[model samples]
Target chain A: MDAARFRIRRAAGGIDADAKIINRATLSFVLALLGFGFWKSGFDPTVVWRGLLVIVREPDILINDYVALAGLGPAFVNAGLLALAAWGLLRVTGVLISGPALAAIFTVAGFSLFGKNPFNVWPIVVGVMIFTWVERRPFKDNIIVALFGTALAPIVSEFAFGIGIASPWNLLAGVVAGLAAGFFLTPVARGALDFTRGYNLYNIGFAAGFVGTVTMSALRAFNVPLSGGFAWAENGPDEILPFLALYFASMIVIGLVEDEDALPNLLDLLRTSGRLVSDYPRSFGIGATLLNMGLMGFTGSLLALAAGCDWNGPVVGGIFTLVGFSAFGKHPLNALPPMLGVMAAASLTPYGLEAPGSQLALLFSATLAPIAGAYGPVAGFIAGLLHLTLVHNVGHLHGGLDLYNNGFSGGMVAGIMVPMLDWIRERRRHEP
Target chain B: MNLDATQLMRCGDELAKYLYLRGSRRVRISYDFGEERSFCAISAPDYLLDEAERTRILKVFSGPIQPEIASYYGALAGRRRDGAEIELLGTMAELEDLMVTEGGGTQIVLSRREAEYFGKRKKR
Candidate 1:
């Protein structure tokens, strides 16, 4: 059965005991993570409110570095609130709480740690809603895509206040840009899928990257200097380390509580190629999916610590994204190869291993996990190497407008590599 | 408990009905009944046996049957460029020797006694 049908059946009183427990546990875990961030930020809701004002008023173009603008406490609080807002939207929409939805929610929260805030993310969201209204379709149809589509949200922030124009004109231009981005996203994302054929998990990211590129190019032609911005926080990892451990450990405990076969099921999930359309919640049950996500998060945190990287907003955001994707199409086996490949490139190239850009790339490299899953580890390593090399250069195309820069690079790498792998597999099958 | 000709026909009709409801089209079932065991071949264009339908059929076949006289074992055999072949084995006793393929399609050869079941029998 499809996810929609499964949800219907669940609602019709045939609820699986394991599924019920797992759903509650997953929601609780997210709420807890957010609460911890708030607590760590001294529980000052007013500070977060002020920080959010600062986040919105500024031009949040690519690499704007939210952590640098807002203090760590406020930035984390903004992320937490944004995640909660996404959760609330799911509730209001009466959408089934599934692995995919969880992934979307965590992604919002993760990106909130960096580029997304309640203010800028919503215009793109409303723009998507406008698309659905004009198309006369249910909002649920594009809810997931709309949330992920906020990769272009930076365009809204940049156009709104960054451009030197009078009040009404700047605001009008910003709204128009946001509406256009959201409107074009559906068709562009759908078309881009054929290019990757479901190999690159961040299909929307790739689409947004292209959209961002074209939009940025158009604006730049008129002499709008789209500055490529980047900054990282220099916070010590003292509190962040313990928080990461607890957050991931809680996920493991919740998984164990929800399912008896979580360990074996998680291992089974790992055996899959982590391809698109692989929903762990449906296949291995929600409990095992949560287990895999917890493990993935822990693994990401460990890698960051080993590289001597701080747990800043972007780094945490990247880790959150990797962990969230584990529910949809990521596993330890597939994710590790690309990450290690990035680390290798960092060491060999002029980039320092602990550089912010390299660390961000290392975490985002999980976007190419499908290659590792489908091919062997060696192929995965090659894809990762290619991704790191291309990622730094691709930013110039959009001038840092596309937030998921690694995703754009991953799509290109997969487009080039998967067909070759398919050809080789066919030939080997025919040989001898 | 060997099935009579009428019982054999009923089994085929019932199985075909099950497959048809689950999206299989142009299903063809060929059968041969011996004194002790029976052989049946069920083939349809591979498109009909999507992941969901395949899983459904396996569940239905393995599920308990009232007044059980025989147990069914299924293996996927030949594949057309378009679809695949599914074979079902019904017996009063289970086979001791089972050949397993890790990644290849499952194939179970018909015995000489059941050779007539080899040919396709189109259903109306």
Candidate 2:
């Protein structure tokens, strides 16, 4: 009995050690992003401050790249700071930084380059906090949801600055709206999962889309004039490409340094369908999880470059999101089919391969990688094709208020496909 | 290791559902409590699971406990048809036993301990 107890204790210790490594790696990435940002701005405090002001004041709707609006330095700084704050919140709440936590933090950082900002994301988080208080649950329980709930950060910015509202009233309205969105997000997101049945990895995105749609409808009814536009950074691939290569390569190196069996473990990981709650850090250890993340990041980058797409803000944001989710429900094998489907759609449709929207669709379509993982690659390709067709049109529903537009679209695609695929499989099984 | 009543019930529910899908018409679940540990044992007589299926079940049930993932997705436990929720169950409780009975039946025991439970509670 003592030997059995000791074995259990030793196993628990191993899990703890892996968790610590993941936490450290995530923190190191955050610091590197911060240092890179400062270096890019030549350590000019004035430039960073000015750029940050521009980022905060902008109506950060869909296609609004902070890199273009405020330059590369402030954009990176904003992302790094937001991610750091998110990581700090998890630590303070006594939440273990696991695979999902890593995904949420990296996602917060990634989207900050395009939509999320320090000023606008807090209201929604505070709202989630309020929710936990109401439910009498610990804040740590819903911290991941709070981080992902920032998908609606643009709602705050749009309400505060875009609707032509004047002064403090606009800011007040934005805060109230953000709080309301966050308050309902948890319950709605939980319910939303049933709609997709865990096929769509970004469950919060689907819920936020519903919230954003209703909010947009209300704004439209009030005769609010919402003008849509796009802001993409066209230059800087020379710098961005090398930086990404080094960052992703470092992840692989770290993985190899941490674990001797990372390669075999990663192969084992790729064999399983990346369904929700597929916590790779726990299943394959943090070492293999990190290796998968780096490989997925490189796959996304190579896909964009091969398609003749420029390395822009949204493009980088898309790749970053892919990297983050790699530890959760994505890998190169499962993700590639959907991405290829998006690339094929771009080639066939009027949306050219180099188009910003098409490039993003290619990367974000990995949200449906579980489809390919569960079904076959052919089904995944179909999902990706459908995602491209629908994602372009759904933004008008939310009026670009949701940053995870691909998630919203992926939910619809999954909802449509899963039932039919199940029926087909059932019929085939019975035919024998 | 000491799960609340609700969590323990969920563990039983997930096991029952998993067994039901695998052709077990009746599942017997019993609980045991002690000062140091608590356990739930789910048993089915003359179970028909093959070696491959048994291996897969054991692998998933023996996976590490991930409380964070459980907190976010626990609501879906026992509601999924693809056995994914069983994965979530593995994240909440430890597998204690997967043994064959004299009648060629299967009994699986899941356990939680007071020490680890209080340790986590203190960390929280």
Candidate 3:
């Protein structure tokens, strides 16, 4: 049955009676972020604008927390505005703001807190538009890919600001690099799915990793020195924790209020192996999807806090990405195992669980949730363990230009583990 | 639903490969272009699809046509012969019929309506 049919069946059963409510709910969520951001800034235009200017001028590599660069007010404002713009783009393209669309939107918002920005992201988006035009295909067909492909937005920032080139030429080179990255992203992303076989839900990250590696290689060939560092805000948890708790709690409340069958539908959703294309909104109702998203948000926050990590920009961004993907793939049942695997691995390694890298590994390891959903917790645990080690090492290859470094590592883990697991399963069946 | 001719052909290719893997040596594929809908039927005369197999295949094809997923990952449909591949094919097209002939052959018909295809295009 289609989503419309599913809705009709639910309505007939006297459960979820509303249709097209997810869009309105998503719009309201964006608006609330904007509202919170303005309130936090005391509605001072100068403060917000200055913060934004600082953010846009930054190189925005890995660990460049906007909160530390500017302040809490600008970070949230940037995230909220980017999310709003994404929502508007989807609307203009006639794309339904459903599970995958929401995933992309929230990811944009999440990464905006650290890496992506309004100025750096546009070149890549325009490049995708040009690709669509050249191919003579409707941009709507590839809008989600274009949105997610902004994982390489750092490439634009790096070329424009970080590299020591003259002003106009530097800007020109950055736009050209960004355009090339975006133009090739759709094809590369589609092909990269075969490598992981859809086990890694962040396929765009995997693709961006490859593109970033090439771009980095080209830059290094010209003797361009690339440096990596961190800009973490140590005092972020005090303010961020309360906001996250309230926001997630509201999601659960709204979900229950909207659908009588939200709990049952959520259970049904959890049973499926959340492989690629496992759209919760289309399979389950929006109410259940919202509930799942809320639950996953809390799960991510709990894991980070329990590991003694602050609710910094990257941590919050990771949590938001986890929450968004809950509607598409991740859920409490499947997402927990990989996180546990990362935590367990951190205990044995020299990197303490409280370290920023370890904290992020714990949260972003949920990219391998489909492994747990498909092959059970043990496989998921192993995938997460492997992902932690590889993620830390692979950043230099892309020079921290690829924001979803965990995703790149997760793809490698899936590509290696899935084939081995399948062979083992086949051998076990024959042995029996 | 808004599929081009190449995409429709890819759908046929996926069905062909699936049937080939399931002990169908000689698969016959035909297309019927009507005013409202375009139909592609792939039939295998040599293979007798059992009740369990028929039911499983029907379940795979019974899911909704997710245009968003199809547009993103549709190219991967026929490349792998895993359950996920078949499931992805399910999201691409609507199942019209699965019939067993008197000679114990299986014919599966999948469809895309011109109205839905053009409708979405016009919206663009």
Name the best candidate (by DockQ): 3
The interface RMSD values of the models, given in order, are 20.1, 8.6, 7.3
- State each model's C-alpha RMSD to the native: 13.1, 5.0, 4.5
Candidate 2 interface RMSD (Å): 8.6
lDDT of each: 0.68, 0.82, 0.81
| Each model's fraction of native contacts | 0.00, 0.24, 0.26
Alpha-carbon DockQ of candidate 2: 0.24
In the range A116-180, model 3's lDDT, one tens digit per residue, is: 99888988888887877666566877898889999999988888888877888988988988999
Query: Mind giving the per-residue lDDT tens digits that candidate 2 earns over B1-124?
Result: 3223446567888888878877788789998765566689999885855565566557666556655566567766766665535657776678888886568587888886433222323321
Q: Per-residue lDDT for A294 in model 1? A: 89
CAPRI-wise, candidate 3 is: acceptable
* Candidate 2 clashes between residue pairs 3 or more apart in a chain or in different chains: B1-B112, B1-B113, B1-B117
Please name the candidate that would achieve the greatest TM-score relative to the true structure. Answer: 2
Pairs with steric clashes in candidate 1 = B46-B83
What part of the reference interface contacts, as a 0 to 1 fraction, does candidate 1 reproduce?
0.00
Off by over 4 Å in 2: A1-13, A227-229, B1-10, B20-23, B30-41, B48-67, B82-85, B94-100, B109-124
Candidate 1 residue A8 Cα shift, in angstroms, is 18
- Give model 1's TM-score versus the native structure: 0.77
